[model samples]
Target: MPTSICKACARLMKEKEDFPRGNFDSDYCASCVDHKGNLKPRDIIRVNMIRYRVNNTGVSEEEAAEIVDNLMRSLPAWNKPKTPTT
Candidate 1:
């Protein structure tokens, strides 16, 4: 199996379940997209990451937020400027 990193969350995608709607072409991951396969808002992604870190790793909320913020800033999706919708 091939592996790819999610542009939004930096999660390793190794199987169909890792990609949004099992889309191997998707740059993001299932956790980074909605059920309709649209990329979620940055704030929502940030919150989800922070929450996951805090709950799963027993990290402080502030620390998790800091880590998640830095991580998100480094990701391709979050680093790029958003274009206005027509």
Candidate 2:
């Protein structure tokens, strides 16, 4: 069986797993994208979302920091990547 890594969140998935119909050549994993191939606003993948918000929004630095803080809180307490036990 071939394993695939999500382009956005780096989550591992089965390559033969069914992907939503569109995005014919897309390399993203289902958790990172929606049925329409749009990035999902999930805590598991909040890093890029926060960056995009801070860079593209008109909010002040303080507000941006607060937003980032919120996003940080949304993440699980232990987010370290999964590793196989020896």
Candidate 3:
């Protein structure tokens, strides 16, 4: 079986259900994309991740925020350099 990591949430995608719209070519997971297969805003994903961690892992909100921040920074989607607007 092939596996891929979601660029937005770091979710391990081992099955078709794990990918957004069940598309294996997608770099993000279902949780990270909208129904149209567009990636959600970074802040939205960040908040969702933090909430998930706090609820599932029994972690403090602050701790989850910190952990998510570090994790997002290491992810390809969030780690890329930002471009300046013209």
Candidate 4:
């Protein structure tokens, strides 16, 4: 059996253990899937992971929200230039 790499984390995957989905084994690892038990865009996963970390810690709601906002800004989703569609 061949090993495949996770598109997100670059973790090695084994064929028997790996469940490939969406265009033949370009799938993310089980650990990389969304908390809701489904696939999500990479940016969403990145954002949610940070938010989940913030929530897990004993932080105040207002502080956590602020932190998460800053975290998202660090990813610069809004800073990227827009692409023109044909």
Output the number of the lDDT-best candidate. Answer: 3
Better of 2 and 3 by TM-score: 3
Candidate 2 Cα misplacement greater than 4 A, ranges: 15-25, 41-44, 47-86
Q: Estimate, for each residue in 1-86, the C-alpha lDDT of model 1 and write its tens digit.
A: 66798888888999889988788999899999999999999999889999999999999999999999999877888777753322
lDDT of 3 by residue, 1-86 (tens): 56888888999998988887679889899899999999999999999999999999999999999999999988878876842312
Model 2's C-alpha root-mean-square deviation from the true structure amounts to 10.4
Residue 7 lDDT (model 1): 87
Off by over 4 Å in 4: 1-51, 82-86
Show where candidate 1 strays beyond 4 Å. Answer: 81-86
The residue pairs that clash in candidate 3, if any, are none
Candidate with better TM-score, 2 vs 4: 2
lDDT of 1: 0.88
Model 2, range 1-86, lDDT digits (tens) per residue? Answer: 54555545444556545243433355566656776777666554565545556679976666866776664443332233633322
Residue 53: error of model 2 in Å?
23
Q: What RMSD, rounded to one decimal, does every model reach?
A: 5.0, 10.4, 5.0, 8.1
Ranking by TM-score: 3, 1, 2, 4
Q: Over the stretch 1-86, how does candidate 4's per-residue lDDT look in tens digits? A: 55566544444677554444432354565656654546666667555555665778867656766765665444422225532312
Clashes of each: 0, 0, 0, 0
**Model 4 worst lDDT window (10 residues):** 77-86
